[model samples]
Target: MREDTAQEQGLDLEPPVPMEEEKEVMEEMEVEIEDPLPCLSETDTQGIIKGRDLFGYVGIEAVLDQMRRKTMKAGFEFNIMVVGQSGLGKSTLVNTLFKSKVSRKSCTPNYEEKISKTVHLQSVSHIIEEKGVKMKLTVIDTPGFGDQINNENCWEPIVKYVNEQYEKYLKEELNVNRKRRIPDSRVHCCVYFLPATGHWLRPIDVEFMRRLGKIVSIVPVIAKADTLTLEERLEFKQRIRQDLQANGIRVYPQKEYDEDAEDRILNDKIRENIPFAVVGTDKEHQVNGNKVLGRKTKWGIIEVENVAHCEFAHLRDLLIRSHLQDLKDVTHNIHYETYRVKRLNESNANGLALSPLTLENGTLEKSEAESHL
Candidate 1:
């Protein structure tokens, strides 16, 4: 058996290899190979370096300009009020803009299983100026209309507060304790938050906004925007723009408008009645002993719940660019010029010391304010 096996297990039998196989082996061995060079050429390497440099320069310039502005502008505070319907996520928006997560802490009761602790959120109206802009931003988050159990008819009370306080501030001189009082001559703006997913404008929203418009520049904030389909959201925005325009209410212009936007607006019936979404705690459940139903899912809490993502950012940007910008310009003028002239005139009328500049015919002499500043 050892002799018979073709050079058996350990034996070498090497005589009958085919010529074709040998030729194939030789050809494979003869194949040429090329070595790889660097992946990037000189030109490409330079381009990458140039782009990085350019980006660095732009970033550096932005930081420097911000620093310069901070140094030059003192903390100029402007008070703003935010009002909206209950459950429209006004609290969420406030928490987002101020980056404080105040609402989350307040809402922790809903998540807690231990001992069933309840956390009620307080009404917050705090200053949130960007550190660079320091004390410039003072945001007032007002409680929603009809939110309190006892204060169901709260409109008159809020209006009274606004009007009375504004008048008093205008009359009084700047005192240490009264610094919170912004003068009537001050430029103040209001932000009115609404659900972006629902009908363009509810009757209550419009009526309240119209009244607010008379008082200050009111921005119609489209709140809780993430839950809406893209087309529905765009249509909603267009409807709002058209309605506000028709009502003689000024809205900010968009970057671009589709020519067919007008046609789309006329077709949508935004005026159709919608049921109110009652949002409240169980303790405040029955006002006057009547249970209030919550918002329906079709156009309900989900729409308002997503507000943390969309509405707050949009509202923040709109306020900063439109209302806050105007407020800053006006505040600067008042602090530097208008207040000086008005105070001097009032003092002189009260038989106080006369300054170098004379006052005549209810107006200060030329360059009086500039000289005083």
Candidate 2:
């Protein structure tokens, strides 16, 4: 066919391109190819390709020692609050709690100093050190708690004090450049001193614990337990536990907070022995020809540290021994975390927490939260 007729009839009369031109055209073609996956060296037991495990130790376990040394140098904070009415041996118990923890090998006698009643809040701190480990122990005591005839809202001051400490910690946390270790003045535990009433929990006791249980860890104790007989004490404890459960009061080692099976088992034992009947005494009496910490009674000597005589040892063990650090953890992780979430939510609700952090030149605008925090 003629070239003109071939073009109209869809027939090619032109010669093909050269091999070099064809190769150039093929190379110039912008074809998108799907990317192949990376190669896997080995699979773990779970079929995951993480890196190969090295033989021998890398001394990563030394981080624990490093943390220990760092913490030993930095020290730590333990804040406790003792809440109850006067004449419950709150002062004596506080002394006993601290004194028993000290090393007797090089320790001097603990001088008896009267803890005067304050109409308001009072916090006392002492740096306790043992075996190169230092702890800043602060004890908060209220003198006029339930001292008024019409003790209405007596928990206001105590609640205010606890929240204030949390606020201080939160403020430090919210700072643009916070310290490596913020001073933790937050109350780790509140030892609620309940009078040795042979009967059930009183209205004052119920009210106080009901309000305070939400914000802090409360470890209720039966003060002057030496007065109650063993049977009476057991009955009273059962009643108090019932009242606590009925009122929805949360105490230390609460069931919902069991981290694991071991924790649950241990805390279950403590829960069974809740509201430990405790007796405190600074004076020592001669018992069995040996000087021991006990109250000199006309009938016989009531040993303060003796588990048979009272639950003071149990209370002490729970507070200063096994559950001490756990108390602080619960305060920080659970109670303080709850407060923090609510406060953050409130700040957002109040338009204080801005989206994208509403910053200008890395400066925050003044708000009510700034002052409160």
lDDT of each: 0.47, 0.79
Best by TM-score: 2
| Model 2 regions more than 4 Å off | 1-54, 100-119, 353-373
lDDT of 2 by residue, 204-238 (tens): 88988888898899999999998889999999999
Clashing pairs in 1: none
Q: All candidates' TM-scores?
A: 0.45, 0.76
- Runs off by more than 4 Å, candidate 1: 1-74, 101-132, 144-154, 173-187, 251-314, 321-323, 328-373
Please give the distance, in angstroms, between residue 221's alpha carbon in candidate 1 and its true position after superposition.
Answer: 1.6
Q: Which ten residues in a row have the lowest lDDT in candidate 1?
A: 273-282
lDDT of 2 at 100: 46
